[model samples]
Target: MSRTAPAPAGEAAPPRPRRRIPGLGALRESGRLFALAGTTVREAFRRPFQTRELIEQFWFVAAVTILPAALVSIPFGAVIALQVGSLAQQLGAQSFTGGASVLAVIQQASPLIVALLIAGAGGSAICADLGSRTIREELEAMEVMGVSPVQRLVVPRVLACMLVAVLLNGLVSVVGTLGGYFFNVMLQHGTPGAYLSSFSALAQLPDLYISEIKAVVFGFIAGVVAAYRGLNPRGGPKGVGDVVNQSVVITFLLLFVVNVVLTAIYLQLVPQKGA
Candidate 1:
């Protein structure tokens, strides 16, 4: 006997196409983050304590960026000083240009700029590598075999970033100060002690403290964002390339936006009325 035919088009059918669920990917990603983060933390502490992975990751992230950050800071500082000096001169206040220069670099520019560089170069590299592995199912293979990819893959990078970015930012701040110091002290005939004094004067404890805070936060964000983007590529696997590029873009934009908001918050809390 012939089976009853299914309902015709435009009529009720045995079953409608399953409704496309919203955020299938997102829900999956959320679970992945939890799984990834949990495994990362566990492996982070599971070692004999202070293992080779931690050391290697620390070197990888921090060492690679040190030279670039140092090189960039010099020009960055010089440009800042020249621009601020020109503006001050026009306003008949050239005497205070050093103060302005130091303030510009340390207050927000130095650390924030450092964050951008590492986030673009170092962070994006991590994304590309991991994304490639993820798309090829290398991560899946690790999972199926009882290996934790997140622990081996994610934790080292994240830990590296927090350490490296801070160190890089510190280098940025120091080298930048030297550029301003040399320009003000050597070429312009300003006293070395006076230059140091001026720079030091501009950096109150609160300013330096806030700078450290910014470094850690931005570094952590860059690391986590890169890892997240990389581990969750799209297009069924061919999207790895785009994932790396997008990670860089997102890291940069997010860092810049966060920098602005942090600066505003600091200004409000610091109370400029007295000074």
Candidate 2:
């Protein structure tokens, strides 16, 4: 047996490196996500494209998302109409209700509602699917077979999400506008002619364009975030659930920030015109 003697008195061992703050860790993760998104984009346009997978993802996402989108848009439009109509009546600006409600729905509500549905319904589904595959070692087996999982698994999903988002945005805009019209005319006893007349009074071409742009951007963000969380899960069924939860939370936060930034830019570059 060998005996070691300690000769240090009043001397301390070296301190371990401190862990990064949670916020800093989140920033680092976000940087990694951005990098992953760039890589996905690069691989998306590569040869031997996965057209079948893209189509499958498109239908799957649409099937799951459409009902929720429709449900939410109707109530959303009704609420906006009710509130705006009441306010217009109070301010004696009833003639402007159509323009205000339509503008509000298209400019803000529709995109936000569609984004929420994408994140809550479609994003969670993606995360769960990929997370299960990850836990099952399917992704690892793909790597062993020299297949790029990002190209095979993520790119199609991302593209499909973007396509569906554009379509859903248009659907939501139409449905929400109709819902608002129904409420304004039937429930509030507003003149349908006035509502129809002022519908586009405060809107410009840019409004529709911006709404579509927002849908595409939000869809891309949600897809990338979900794929990142799913592909990087720790392990086990619980890990899948955790990743799904995190993906939704992260997507929501990102959407809110992106929406604010995009709205600010739109306001600066394309100010709303008078009725």
Top model by TM-score, which number? 2
> What is the C-alpha lDDT profile of model 1 across 32-122, one tens digit per residue?
7556656666877754444576688677776668788889899888888777766765787656667778877887777887787778878
TM-score of 2: 0.92
Best by lDDT: 2
Clashing pairs in 2: none
lDDT of 2 by residue, 8-30 (tens): 88887566699877699778897
TM-score of 1: 0.79
Q: Name the runs in model 2 displaced over 4 angstroms.
A: 1-22
CA deviation > 4 Å runs, candidate 1:
1-50, 184-196, 235-238, 271-274
**Candidate 1: deviation at residue 119, Å?**
1.7
